[model samples]
Target: MDSGQISIGQIRRSEHLPARIAAQLAAQITEGHLKPGERLPTEHSLSKTLGVSRSVVREAIAQLRNEGLVETRQGVGAFVSEKCARPIRIKDEELGDPQSFRALFQLRVPLEIEAAGLAALHHTAEDLARIDEALAGMTGAEKWTHQGVEADLLFHRAVAEATQNEYFAMFVGFIAERISHAIDAARARAVLEEIVEVTIAEHVVLRDAIASRDPKRARQAMRTHLLGAASRINLSLEEF
Candidate 1:
C-alpha cells in the first residue's frame, strides 16, 4: 500500500459511507501506515481509488480534520497533522462486546432522558411532524430489517432536534449512531413480531408524551423505552 493509497476493497457501501471511510483512514494514520505531515491522496484520487464520490471523500477528510488527525492548506490537499491527538471515540467494532454495549447504553440513557424532557418543553409543530414521520417509518418497516433500525434511529434524532439545543442534538446523534449496530444485533436475536410490536408501542408512548408537551411524562416515557430496549437485548440493567 503506497503512502495514502487506499484500494477499492477498503471501502464499504452503507448509509454511513463517510464515517466508514473516515474510520478506515484514521486507522491507517494511527497504525503508522500514513506518516505525520504526509499529504493525503487528493480528493479526486481518493474518489477514484475508493470508487466513491468526491463529496464522500471530502466528508471523510472533514471528519479526520475535526478529530485533529488531518490538516488542509489553501491551494493544497489535506495532510496528516503533526500532532495528531485523536479525540475520545467509541470504535464501532467495540460495540459487539457486551460490556461496551452496556456502558454505551448507560451513557445514552441520561442524555436521552433529558433530551426527551427538553423536547417536550420546546418542540415545535415541525419537530412533532418529524417524529411522526419516523414513527410511521418504523411502524411500516418489515420486521428485523435495517429499515426499521434506521427509522428507530431517526426517531431518537427527531426527539434530540426537538430539544432545540444543538449540543443535545449532536451528542444524542453520536450516541444513537454508536448503538445502532447493537440494536440491529439485538433485533436479530429477538422474536421478530413480538420485538417489532413492543418496540413500536414504546416509541408511540414516548412520541405521544412529547407531543402532549409534558416534560415529566416525556422523560418517564423515554426511560421506560430505553429500559425495555435493554431487556430485549438480554441485558440486565440491575447488574450494572
Candidate 2:
C-alpha cells in the first residue's frame, strides 16, 4: 500500500482526534476505497497505522457509527454501514466550517449560472417584477442586516423562479436555507463591510441581462456577480 494510503499524517496536537480520524475513514468509505459493509481495520491496527492511540481510534469509530457511516458488532470491530452507499449528510457541527461553505458555494455556481440563462429565455413579466422587488429590498435595507441577507437570498431565489422550472426553484430554495448562516456571516465580514452599493448595482446588471432576453449575457452577468460575491465573502474555492 502507498504510504499516503496508510496515514493522514500527524494530526495537529490541539485538534479533535476523534473527528479527524472519523473524517479520514468517512472519506475512504464514501470514495469506495472502503466498500460498504467491508470490515474496518481493527482499532489496534488503525491506532498503529495512523500513529494514534487505541483510545482515539475507538472513539473515532464510535463517531462514525453515530453518523451512519459505520456499524460495529460485538467482538467483530467496525464495518462500513450500508447507509454509506447513499449520499451522506454532514453533521451540523461541520456546517460552519470554511470547507463546508466552499462546498455549498461550489454547488451554487452552476445552478445559478444556468438559471440566469434560462430566465433570460423564459422569464415572465411577473417574474421580472418579483426579482426587482427583491433587488429593491436589498437596496433599501441597512447593510449587513438579516433583512439584507434575506433580500439577497430572495434575489437568487427569484432568478431560480424565473427559470420557469419548478425543480430549479425548489433546489435553489433548499440551498438558500442551508447556507443562510454563511450568508449572514459573509455579509458581516469587514472586507464586505462597505459593499452595499456595489451589491445592489450588480443585481441591476443581472436583472437587465435577463430583462433584455440575452441568454449568453445573462449567464455571464450571473457568473461575474457570484464570483464577486465569493471574493467578498473571502471564500477560497480553487475550482471557481
Candidate 3:
C-alpha cells in the first residue's frame, strides 16, 4: 500500500466501507494528495484499483458528498470538494500520552464542560433535536464498539453545535473523537476499559442538562463528569 494513497484492502475490511472510504479520502485531501477542483478517478477506475465493486465506489463518493468533500459534475468526473484545506484530524497524542491515559481525561474535562455550558446557553431548537436524535441512537447498540463511539460522538457534537460557534463545534468534535479513540485503545486497563460506558452515561447527563436549557446545571453536570473521569486515570498530574 502506498502510504500516500488509501489502500483497497483497508476499504474492504472497513465496517462501513462507504463512509469510512469517504472519511479516509477526505483526510487524504486535507493531508494534500487530492487538490481542490482536482477530478477524482472515474468510478470504474477506482473500483478496479480499490478492488471494490463499482457500487461501493459510488457509495463512497456519495458519502464524501455529504461531507462536502467532493462534487459531481454532470458530464465530468467528481472533483475534490471545495474548502478542502479544513484541518480535521485530531491526533491522540495531542492530549500527551496514551500510556498514562490520565492526560486524555484531564484534557477533556475542562474543554468539554465549558462547551456544554456554552451549548446550553446558546442552543436552538434544531440543535436540541439533533441531540435527541443522537441520544435515541444509543439504545442497545449490539455492542459498545464502533457504533457506540459514533453515537457518543454525535451527542457531544450536538452540544458543540448548540454553541453556535463554528470553531467551538469543529474543535470540540475533533478533540472528542481523538480522545474517544485513545480510550478505545486502552482496553488492557480495567479502569480505562469501562471508559466507553463511563463516557456514554456522562454524555446523557450533559444531554439532559442541555435539553433543560439551564446553563448552570449543564456546566455543573459536565464538570462533574469530567472530574469523575479525571480521577479514574491512574497517573497523577501536577498541573491539573
Candidate 4:
C-alpha cells in the first residue's frame, strides 16, 4: 500500500475505535468497575491498554468530562466525578404512598402533553416512520413484555425527538425509565387490564393526531389520556 493512500478498513476502524473505547470506559464508571473519585490511568497507559492512539484516549476523556463523569486536575490526572457512578433510584417508599405517586403523575402530564403538541407541528418524515415502527411492535399482543413497554416508550420518545428540541428529547429520556417502572407496577395489578387497553388505544389516537399535524388535538388528547390513566391507577391503588 502506498504511504499516501488510506485503506478502507483503516478508515472504518479508525472511525469506530475511539468511540468504542470511550464507551467501554464509560461503562466501567457507570457499572462501578471504576469507583467514584478514582483517578483514571494516564493517557499513555490507557492508549496502550486499549490499543488506541493517545489522542483517541484524550478525546474519550474529554467526552466523559462533558458528560460529568470525569474531571481533570491540571498537574494531576483525571478522576472519576462523584455524580457518574450513581444510578437514579426511585424507591419503593416513594410509590408506597398514593399522594406522592399522584403528585408525580401531575408533574409528568403537562411536560408530555406539550411535547406531543410540538411534535405534531415539527416532526420530520423519518420521525413519523420511527413512531409507526414502535406502534406496529405494540400491536403484536403476544409479544408485550418489558420490551413492549420500551417500544411504547420509544413511540413517545420519537415524538419528543420530532419536536426538534434537544432539551425535550433529553427530558423525555430522563423520565422514560421511571414512567415505565410506574406503569409496569400498575399494570401488574390484574385490575388495571382495562386501563392497559385504554392506554394503547390512546397511543393510537395520539399518534394519529400528531400524524395529522393537529397540534391542539394532539396536546389535548395526550393530556386526556394521561389523566384517564391517573384515574384508573388511583382506583386500583385504592383497591390495593
Best-performing candidate as measured by TM-score: 1
Residue pairs clashing in model 3 are none
Q: After superposition, how far is residue 88 of candidate 1 from its true place, in Å?
A: 1.8
Q: Which order, best to worst by lDDT?
A: 1, 2, 4, 3
Name the regions of candidate 1 deviating beyond 4 angstroms.
Answer: 1-8, 12-19, 25-87, 141-144, 238-240
Error of 3 at 164 (Å): 0.8
lDDT by residue for model 3 (54-105), tens: 8777767754653456778888878886774344343333445544355555
Candidate 4 backbone overlaps, count: 0
Residues 201-228, model 2: lDDT tens digits: 8889999999999999999998888788
TM-score of 1: 0.72
- Model 3, residue 145: C-alpha shift (Å): 3.2
TM-scores of the candidates in the order shown: 0.72, 0.59, 0.64, 0.60
List the global CA lDDT of all models.
0.81, 0.76, 0.66, 0.69
Q: Give the per-residue Cα lDDT of candidate 3 at 132.
A: 85
Comparing candidate 3 with candidate 4, which one achieves the higher TM-score? Answer: 3
- The CA root-mean-square deviation of candidate 4, after full C-alpha superposition on the true structure, stands at 12.2
Q: In candidate 1, residue 192 scores what lDDT?
A: 82
Worst 10-residue lDDT window for candidate 3 reads: 84-93
TM-score of 3: 0.64
